[model samples]
Target: MGLQKYWRIVFVAVLLALAMIYREEAERIVNIVVSSPPWLFFACLFLVVAEFLLQALRMKLVFSKNWAEILRAYAVGLMVALSFPSRTLGEGARIAVMAKELKVKKEEMAAYVSVERVADVVVLATAASLVLLEVHPFLLAAAVLGICTFLAVIESDTVYRKVSRGPVPELLRKYIEESRKIVKDRALFAAILGISVVLWGIDFLRMWVVVHTMGGTIDYTAVASLVSLAYIVSALSFLPGGLGVYEGGLAGGLVLKGVPHDVAVAATLYERLFSYWLWILVGAAAGAFKRENGSSSTA
Candidate 1:
C-alpha cells in the first residue's frame, strides 16, 4: 500500500513534467477544446447522469428498498470519497450513511459494499484483459491475473478460515455467506452485473462523446482499452478521487495512441467535468436536502 502511494505521487510528477515540456501542444489543444458545441456539452452531461443513475439502480438492486435514502447516502458518500484522502473513505461513508439513516448494520453493509467492489474488479479486469489483448499484452495479462486473484481470494475457504482465526471480528464470514445467498438468485445477480456493465459502458461513452465534441476521433476499441487502462491504473491510487492520475493517464494514453495532444487533454478535462465535478455537485445537493443525518426507512 505504501509503495502504491509513492507510485501515484511519482505518476503525477512524471505527468506534470511531460505537460510542461509539451506546453505549446497542450495550449493549441485547449484552443480547439474551447469551441465545443453546446449540444455536445449537454450530451456529455446526460451520459454522466446516466452513469450515476445506473449506480443508484445497482444499489437498489442490492438493498431492495429505501431507495431515496440509499441514493442520497450514495451521493453523499461519493462526495466524501472523492473529497477526502484515502479513497476507501468513500466506502466508509457509504456504510456510515446507511447505518445512520437506514438502520443497516455495519457488518452487512460492509459486506454489501465489499462484494460489490470485488465483483467490479472481476468484471473490469476481465473486460480490460480482452480489450487490451492486441493493444497492450502486458496490461492484458495483468488484468487477467487480477480477475483470477480477486476471485481466488473471494472463493478460498482457506482465506476465510484464516481470517476467522485472526482478530477480524466478523471475519466477513457473515457477509460472504450472505453474498453467496444473494448470488444464488441468478436473476438478481444477472441484473446487478448487467447494471454494472451498463454503468461502466456509459463511462466509456461519456469520454468518447467528449472527444468527439472536441473534434477528435479515435477507434472505439482502442479508446475502450485506453479508458479501461486509465481506470485500472488510477483505481489503485491512494490519491483523493484518484485525481491527477486518472486525468493524466486518460489524456496521456489518448495522445500516445495517436490522438492530437491538445484535443486529448481537452476531452479528458471535459469528461472529468461532467463525471467527477458535476457528480460532486449532485452529491452536495443530496447532502443538503437531507437532515444533518439521514432519515430511516424500512429497506
Candidate 2:
C-alpha cells in the first residue's frame, strides 16, 4: 500500500511538472476560461446536471430502483473510476454498491450494468462514425457492421444457449440469462437507446459550448467526433479518468481542426472541469456521506 501511494504521488508530481513546463500555455488557458461569459459556464453546468439525472433515470429504468439510490451509486462509481487506474473497475464498483444497497444479487446487477454499458458504447460509436462519415466512410461502414453483428449475437438465444452449455460458470450463466431478458425487452431497449442518444447529444453540445467559450469556432460534428475519439482512446489507455491521455488527445485534436493551441487547451480544461473534475468532487462527497451514515448506523 505504501508503494502504491508512492506511485500515486509520483503520478501527481509528473502532472504538476508538466503544468509547470507549460506555465505560459497554462496561464493563457486560464485567461481564456476566466474571460468567458458567465452564461456559458452556467450552460455547461446545466448540461452536466442533466447528464447525471439522465443516467440515474437510465439505471432506474434498467433496475427498477429508486432514482436517488441509483444516482448515489453512479456518483460513487465515478469517484472510484477517477481514483483508480482502470475505469472498468468503476462499473464493477457500481454493481457492488447498487447490489448491496438494493439487496439484489451482484450477478443480476452486473447484467443491468452490462446492458447499460453496451448500449452506451454502441450509441456513442454510431454517432461518432456518422459525424466522421465525410472524413472516414470506411469507419462508418465498419462501425455499422460491428454494431449489427454484436446486436445479432446478443439477440440470439441459440448462441446464448450454446455458450451457456459449454463450461460457463454458474454466476456467468445467471448474468447471461438476466442480460438476455433485458435485451429482449423491445420497449425497454428502445427507451434506453433513446436516452443514450439524448445523453450523447448533450455531451456534444457541452463540448461545443466550451470551445466557443474559449473563443474557438469549430463545427458541431467536428467537436462530437473529436470528443468521441478522445474518449475511446483514453478508455483504452486505462489511466484514471483518462487523465493525461484525454487532455492531450482532445487538445491535439482541436488544434488539428484549426483551433489555436491555447484555445484548445483552454477548451479541454474547461470542459473537463465540469465533466470530469466536478463529478469526482460530487462522488467523493457522496462516498463520504454514505460512509458516515454507515458508521452512525453501526454505532
Local distance difference test, each candidate: 0.71, 0.80
After the best TM-score superposition of candidate 1, give how far the Cα of residue 5 lies from its true spot, in angstroms. 19
In candidate 1, which residue ranges exceed 4 Å CA deviation?
Answer: 1-27, 130-142, 149-168, 292-299
> What's each prediction's TM-score?
0.80, 0.90
Please provide, for model 1 over 205-281, each residue's C-alpha lDDT reduced to its tens digit, 9 standing for 90 to 100: 77877776676778766677678777777766666677777888988988887887778988887787776677567
Candidate 2 TM-score versus the reference: 0.90
Residue-by-residue lDDT tens digits, candidate 2, 14-45: 86787799988777777888999999888999
Total clashes, candidate 2?
Answer: 0
After TM-score superposition, the amount by which residue 26's alpha carbon in candidate 1 deviates from its true location, in angstroms, is 5.3
Distance from true position, residue 81, model 2, in Å? 2.4
Model 1 poorest ten-residue lDDT run: 290-299
Candidate number of the best lDDT: 2
RMSD each, Å: 5.3, 2.5
